[model samples]
Target chain A: METFSVIFQLLLALSILVVLHELGHFIPARIFKIRVEKFYLFFNPWFSLFKYKKGDTEYGIGWLPLGGFVKIAGMIDESMDTDQMKQPAKPDEFRSKPAWQRLIVMIGGVIVNILLAFFLYAMIAFVWGKDYVKNEDHIHGIEVLTPTLVGDNLFQNGDKIISIEDEPLSELMQANNKMLINQAKNYTIERNGELVNITIQDEGIDYMLKKESIVFIPRVPTQIDSVMPTGIAQELGLKKGDQIQQINGMDVSMFDQFRKELTTMKENNLDSFDLVVNRNGQELAFSSRFDTTYKLGFQNVFFLTHDFKKTHISYSLGQAIPEGIALAQTTLMDYVNQFKLIFTKKEAVKKVGGFGTIARIFPTTWDWKIFWSRTAFLSVVLAFMNILPIPALDGGHVMFLIYEMISGRPPSDKFLEKAQMFGFFILLFVMLYANGNDFYRWFTGQ
Target chain B: MAYYIGVGIAVVIIAFFMAATQKARGYNFWRYFIVSIVVVAGIYMMIENLVLNPK
Candidate 1:
C-alpha cells in the first residue's frame, strides 16, 4: 500500500508538470501558426502506448516514462528529422518563424513552470494555512543532541534562542531552517536571562545537516506517557506520569538528552544502568537491563503532544495569495543558495538525491496537502533546471534565438541538430550520475 | 543468449539509422559501411564499459 501511494503520487506529479510544461510550448507555437507534428507525454522509441491525430498534430502517451516532448515542424530537435530539413520550409513551420516568436516559444515552458509553482503554493496556503510554534514556546529552551561536533561550546542546555543575526523567529520559515540554509555567522540566545552572542562556523552548519538529529527542537521534559507491557520498562517498575530526571547519575532534563544518554550507555556496553524518576513528588531510582534495540520501550511526552505549545493560523483566500507568492519566492531563493553549496561544500555531494529519493520523500499514505506541497517545490526545481543555458534545454533554444535576434543570422540547421544531440548526451550523463548515486546508496545501505 | 541477441538487435538498429542518415546527406562515396561498423562497435563497447563493467 505504501509503495503504491508513492508510485501513484510520483507519476501524477510528473504527468501534471510534463503536460503543463509541454503546453507552455504548444500554446505559443499554435499562436504563431507553427505546425506541431506531435505532442507526447513520454518518448516512443519503437511504438506508443496510445496516440491520436488531430489537425496537424498527433497527441499520444509514449511507452518510455523518462520525459515528454513536443515535436515542432521544421525544427531540428532531438527527433532528428533531417529528411524534412532537405525539403523547402513551409510558412507554418517553426524554422520559418521570426526570432522573437521563436524566443517566446522556447521560454514558454519555463514561464509556465514558474507560474505553476507560485499558483500551487497559493492554493496550498489557502487550504492548509500554516501551523507552527512560537519562539517563546520553547519553555525549556532548545535541545541540542550533537555532543561531539556541536558541544556546549556552541550552546548550553536551557539556552533560549532569541534570534539568528537579529532576525526573530518562530517554528516556521523565518527560523532555524533559515539559519542552517543561509549558514548565518551568529545568533543570540538567552542564557541565564542574559543575551549571549554565539558564533557559528561553516562546519557547524554542515554538522547540523549531516546529523539531522542535531536540529533544535523544543526541549520537552522527559515525562513518561506510557510504558510497554513486556520491555525493560516493565521489569524496571517504571510507570506512567514518571518524570525521568537522571540517567546513569547524569542529569537529563529533555527527552532528546535522555535518548543520547541511552545511546552512549549502549555504546559503552553497559548492560545495567539506572534511572532517577520523580514519581508523585518522590525521587525514585530504578535499574534496568539494556535490550538489543537499546530502548526501554516507553513513550515520552514530546513535540506535537499537548505539552508543547503550538499555534495555527487558518488563512482566508484573500490573505493566502500574497503569502503563497512570498513563500514560493523564498523557496526558489533558498534552493538557489543551497545549490551553490554543491560547489562550495564537499559533503554536499552526499546530499544530492535523484528521482528515487524524490519518490520516497512523499508521505507513505496519500495526503493531498503534502503531495501538493512537494509538487509545487518540484515545479520550482523544473523551472530552474529548464532555464539553464545548456544545449537541448529550453534555455539553450532561447540562447540561440537571442543570438539570432542580436546578430540577425540563425545558426545553420546542421549545427542546431548537432547541438540538440550533444544536449541529449549531456542530459543522459547527468541522469546516470544522479540515479547511479541513488542506486549506490541503496545497494550499500547508506 | 537472449541478452546477446538484444544487444545485437540494438547495434543493428543504431547502425542502420546512422548509416541511412550518412547516405541521405550525400556521403554515399565515403564507405558508409565503415560508419555502420563503427556505430555498432562503439555502442557495444560503451554498453560494456559503462553498464556491464561497474568499477
Candidate 2:
C-alpha cells in the first residue's frame, strides 16, 4: 500500500510536469505559426498507446515513459524525419520561422517549467505555511557522529551549535546544508557550559563529502517507554521508566548514542553486554545477552512527545506569492550549486540518480503537503536540467539558435542532424550513468 | 548475479538493434554496431542498477 502511494504520486507528478513542459512548446509553436506535427506525453516509436488528431496537431500518450516532446515540423529533433527535411522548407515549418521566433519556441518549455515551480511553491506555502525547529529549541544540544572530531577536539558530544563563521544559525534542521553551502571556516558551539570556537579544516569537508557522513544529530535522552513481553529486555528484567545511562561500559547519555553503541557491539559480534540504568533514584547494573537479531526489544519514549519550541512562519495568500517566488529562487540556486559540486567533487557524482532515486524522495504514506512540496522541487530541477547547454535538450536547441542568430548562417541540415544524434547519445549516456549509480547504491546498501 | 543477467540482456538487445540498423543503412554495420554497444551498455547499466538495487 505504501509503495503504491509513492509510485502513484511519482507518476502523477511526472505526468503533470511533462504535459506542462510540452504545452510550453506547443503554445509558442502555434503562436509562431509553426506546424506542430505531434505533441506527445511520452516517446512514441512504432505506435502510440493513445492518440487523437485535432486539426493539424496529433496529441497522444506514448507507451515509452522516457519523456514527452512537441514535434515541430522541419526541425532536426529526436523524431529524425529526414525525408521531410530533404524537401523544401514549407511556410508553416519550424525552419521557415525567424531566428527570434524559433528561439522563443525552443525556450518555451524551460520557461513554463520555472513558472510552474514558482506557482506550486506559492500554493504550498499558502496552504501549509513554513515550520522550522529553531536552534534554541535544541535544549539537549547535539550528539556528534564523527568519532574523529571528538578525538581531535573539534567537537564534543552534547555540543550546541550556535553559529557558523559568526552567522547565527536560525534552524537546527538546516544546519548541515548551511554549513556545506556556506563552506564555513569556523563553528561556534556551547559545550560544557562555555562557548567554544572550532576551526573547520578543508580535510574535514572532504572527509564529510567522501564518506557521506552525518556530522551530528539532535540529542534525546534514552528513556525506555516499554519492553516487549518475551523479548530480550523483558527476559533480562528491564522495565519501563528505566533510563539507560551506559551500554557495554560506554557512556551513552542520549538515545542516539545508545543506539550507536548497540550497533557497534553488534558489529563487533558481542553476544553479551553490560548495561547501567538509572531507575527511580538508584543506578542499577546488569549484564544481558542479545537475541538472534541482536535487538534489545525495548521502545524508546516517543521523541515528538517532548515539548520543543518550533518556529512557524504562516503567510497570508498575498504574502505567499512573493515568499513562494523567493523560495523557488533559493531552491534553484541551491540546485545549481549542487550541480556545480557534481563536477568539482568526485564523491558528488556518485549521488546522481534517476527515477528510482526520485521515487524514494516521496514519503511512503501519502501526504498532500509533502507531495506538492516535492513536486515543486522536482519542477525546479527539471527546469534547470532542460536549460543546460547539452544537445538534444531544450537548452541545446537554444544554444544552436543563438549561434545561428549571431553567425547569421544556420548550420546545414546534415550538420544539425549529426549534432542532434550526438546530443541524443550524450543524454542517453548520462541517464544510464545516473540510473546505474542508483542501482549500485541500492545493491551495495550505500 | 542480477547485474550480469541485465548486461547479457542489454547486449542481445543492442545486437538486435545493430542488425536492424545494418539492414536499413546497408553499410557501416560495424560503426553502428559499436555505437549501439556503447548506447546499450549505458542503458543496460541503468536498468541493471534499478533491477539489482531498487531502493
Candidate 3:
C-alpha cells in the first residue's frame, strides 16, 4: 500500500512540475504575441491523449511522460518545426523577434521554475516551518556498518557523540546537515562521561549524505505498537502492548539485537521465529512467520513522531525573499561543484539519479511537507540544469545571445544547427544515463 | 546551512550584477566576478568538508 501511494504521488508531482514548466514558456510566448503551435504537457511524437485547437494553439497531453514542451512558430527546438522555418518568417513568430525579447521567451520557463520553487519553499516554511535532529540528540551514536575501520579504532556502540573533528556536535548537527556533509572527518566524543578522541576518514561519509534513513537505537524496548490486519504479525496473534523479550531462546535485550538475529535466519531459510513476550508481567510464547524480509511486530514510530524535537526558523516575508533567493543560489552552486567534481575526476557523478531516485524521495503516504520539500529541491535542480552553458538549453541560448551582443554578429545558422544537435544528443544521453541508473538500482534491488 | 547560505548570498549578488550590467561591453566584470566567487566557494566547501567537519 505504501509503495502504491508513493508511485501515485510521484506521478502527480512530476506531472504538475512538467506542466507548470511548459506553461511558463507558453504564457510568455502568448504575451509576446508569438504563435504557439502546440502546447503539450509532455512530448507527443506518435500519439497524444488529448488535443484541442483554439486560437493558434493545439493544447494537448502527450504520451511520453518524461518532459513537456511548447512549440513556438518558426522556433528551432525539440519540436523540429523546420517546415515553418523553411517558409517566410512571419511578424508574429519567434525567429522574427528582437534579441532581447527572444531571449526572455527562451529563458522564460527557467525563470518561472525558479520563482515557483521559491514560492513553494516559502509556503512550506510558513506552513510546516523546518524540523531537524541534533547529532547529540541521537543518544545512540552512529553505527559503523562498513567492513573496514579507518578511525582511531575505538568505535563502539553507546559512545556519546560530542563533535565531528573538534566542532560542537549540537551546533553542527542542528542546521541543514551542512556540518555532516561539509565536515566528514575527525571526532571528539565522551565515553562514560570522559572525553576521548578519534579520527575518522571521509571515505564512508556517503551513507550519512542520504537525506532520509532509519537510524536504529540500541537497548530500546520491543513493545508491539500496532499491526496490519493482514500482516504476518496479525496472523500470528501479535497485539499492541506485548513486550517481546526473547526470540528463539536468544535473550534479546533490545530491538536491534532481535533484528540482527532475525537477519541471520535468512541463511538457514528459516521464515519463522519463536517470540517470547511479557504481557502484563506474564511470560507468553508464540510463533510467527516472517513476511518479505524478517520484519516482526516491533513498534515503529510514525515519521512525524519519530523525532520529537523542533528546529524553528523564523524569517520575515521581507527577509525570506532574499533568503529564498540565496537558498537557490547556494543550492545551484553546490550542484555546479558536484558536476565539476564529476568532470574533474574528484567525485563519482554517475551516482546522479533520475526518476527512480525522485520517486524514492517521497514518503509512503501523502505528506504535503515532504512533497513540497522534494518539489522545491527538484526545482533548484532543474534551475541548475537549465543554466548549464550547453547548446540545447536556456544557458546555451544565453551563451549565443552574449556572443552576439559582444561580436555584433550571430553564428551562422548551419553552425548553430550543428551545435544544437550536438547539445541535444548530449542532454539526451545524460537523461538516459541518469534514468538508467534508476532502472539499474530497481532491477538489482539495490 | 551557513556555508550553503553564504554561497546563496554570493550567487544572488553575482546574478544581479550580471543581469544589471549585461548590456555593457568590454572586460565582462560580472563574468569574472562569478567565476571568482565559484572558485572561492568551491575551495572553501572542500576544505571545510575535509578539515573542519563536526564529528
Candidate 4:
C-alpha cells in the first residue's frame, strides 16, 4: 500500500508533465499546419494499449511508461520515420515549415515545462506558505554529531553555526543536510561571541558518505512530556515534565545522550540503573529494572527536543508569483550544481539513483503539499534536461535549427539520422545504467 | 518485468541478425563490430556499476 501511493503519485506526476509538455509542441505544430501523426503518452514500441484517431492525429497511451512524444510529419524525431522524409517535403509537413517556426515548435516543450514549474511553485507558496527555522533561532546552538567530527578541538559545545561551505546558514533544520549535500569540508561557528573557522579532515567525508548521515544535532535537554500508562516509567513513579539529567549515574544533558544511555544499558544488561530527574526545581531519583526492551514509557517533549523555533508565513497571490518563480530558479540552480558534482566528485556519481529513488521521496500517505512540491521540482528538472543540446531531445532539433539559421544551410537528412541514433544510444545507456544501479542495490542490499 | 526482458532479448538477437545482413550487403566489418560492442557494453555497464562495483 505504501508502494502503491508512491507509484501512483509518480505515474500521475509524470503523465501530467508529459501530456502538457507534448501539448506545448502539439499546439505550435498545429498552428504552423504541420501534421502531427501521433501524440502518445509513453512510447508505443510493439503496440499501444489503446488509441483513437482524430483529425490528422492518433492519440493513445503506450504500455511503456518511459516517456511520451509527438510525432510531427516529416520530422526525424524518436519515431525515426525515415520513409516519410524520403519523399519530397509536403506542404503540411514539419520540414516545409520556416526555420524560425521549426525552432519555436522545438523549444515549446521546454518553455512550457519552465512555466509549469513556476505555476506550481506559486500555487504552493500561496496555499501552504513556507515553514522554516532560521539559524538565529537556534539559541542553544548545535553539536557536531559526526563521530570524531575531525577532532575534539574543532567545535566547542553549544557552538552556533555561522556558515557552511562559505554560504550563510538560513534554515537551522536543513543545516546538517546542507553540509552533506555540499560535501562541505569547512564551516564557521560562533563560540563565546567569537567566530572560528574549522576545516574537517578526510575522515569527516567518510562519515558523511559511509556512516550515520547527520552532521549536527541541536543541543537540548531531555524533558519528559508524557508518562505512558501501565509502562515502566509510570511504574517507577516517573512523571511528565521531569527533565532527565542522568541515567545509571552517568551524566546525560541532551535527548540524544539519554537515548544513547538507554541503548548502552540495554546492551550491557547492567544490574543497577537509576534516573536522576529535575522536576519543578527539585531533584528526584527513580530506579529501573528494565526488561529486554529498555523502553521508558514516558515520551520526551518532542517540540523542545530541537533548539530552533519554526516559522511559517503565507503569501498573497501577487507576492507568491515572484516567490514561486524565484523558488523555481533556485531549484534549477541547485539541481545543476548537484548534477555537475556527478562529474567532479567521485562520491557524487555513486549516489546516483533511478526510479526507485525518485519514488521513495514521495510521502507514504497522500500529501498534496509535498506531492506538488516534488512534482514542481521535477518540472524544473525536466525543463533543464530538455534544453540540453542532446541530439535525440528537443534541444537537438533546436541546435540544428540554430545551425541552419547561422550557416544558411540545413544538415543532410542522413547526417541528422546518424546524430539522432548516436544521441538515442547515449540516452538509453544512461537510463539503463541508473535503473540497473537501482536493481543492483535492491538485489545486493547495498 | 518479463516483458522488458523479453524485449531486450529480442532486440539483441535482431540487432545481431541485422549486423550480419549489413555485412552481406557490403557494410564494413568495423560497423558490425561497433554495433555488437555497443549492445554488449551497455549491458555490461549496468551490471558492473550498479551491482558488481566494489564499495
Best by lDDT: 2
- Kindly list the per-residue Cα lDDT of model 1 for residues A146-245, writing each as its tens digit: 5642555587667887888888765522445665678777878888899888886765567765764345656778888999988988788889989999
Expressed as tens digits, the lDDT of each residue in A300-320 for candidate 2 is 875465446777889899999
lDDT of 3 at A5: 89
Residue-level error in angstroms, candidate 2, position A169: 1.3
lDDT (Cα, tens digit) per residue for candidate 3, span A259-321: 677778876788778888888889988887777766664454332344435567776776666
Tens-digit lDDT string for candidate 4 (A1-446): 98899999999998999999999999999999999988888756556788999999999987767677787888887545666789999999999999999999999999999999999999999999998777788676776666576354686557888898888888665665555555677888888898898887555555666563666766666887789887888888887778898987888867777888888877887756788889899999888687667788878775344435788889999999999999999889878877876786676666778888788779899999999999998889889988889898989989999999999999999999999888866765666667656766787888
Ranking by lDDT: 2, 4, 1, 3
**Candidate 1 vs 3: which has more DockQ:** 1
Docking class of 1: incorrect
State the displacement of the C-alpha of residue A104, model 3, in Å, after optimal TM-score superposition: 2.2
TM-score of chain A of 2: 0.87
Give me the candidate number with maximum DockQ. Answer: 2
The models' CA-based lDDT, in order, is 0.78, 0.80, 0.65, 0.78
Clash statistics: count for each candidate: 0, 1, 5, 0
Off by over 4 Å in 4: A45-50, A148-153, A165-167, A181-186, A201-206, A224-235, A239-241, A248-250, A259-271, A280-282, A289-308, B1-42, B45-55
Regions of candidate 2 where Cα sits further than 4 Å from its true position: A151-153, A202-213, A235-242, A245-252, A256-296, A301-307, B1-6, B12-38, B41-55
Standalone chain B TM-score for every prediction: 0.66, 0.58, 0.47, 0.45
Question: Model 3, which residues run further than 4 Å from truth?
Answer: A1-4, A46-48, A147-156, A159-183, A186-199, A206-341, A344-350, B1-55
Give the lowest summed-lDDT range of ten residues in model 3 chain A: A211-220
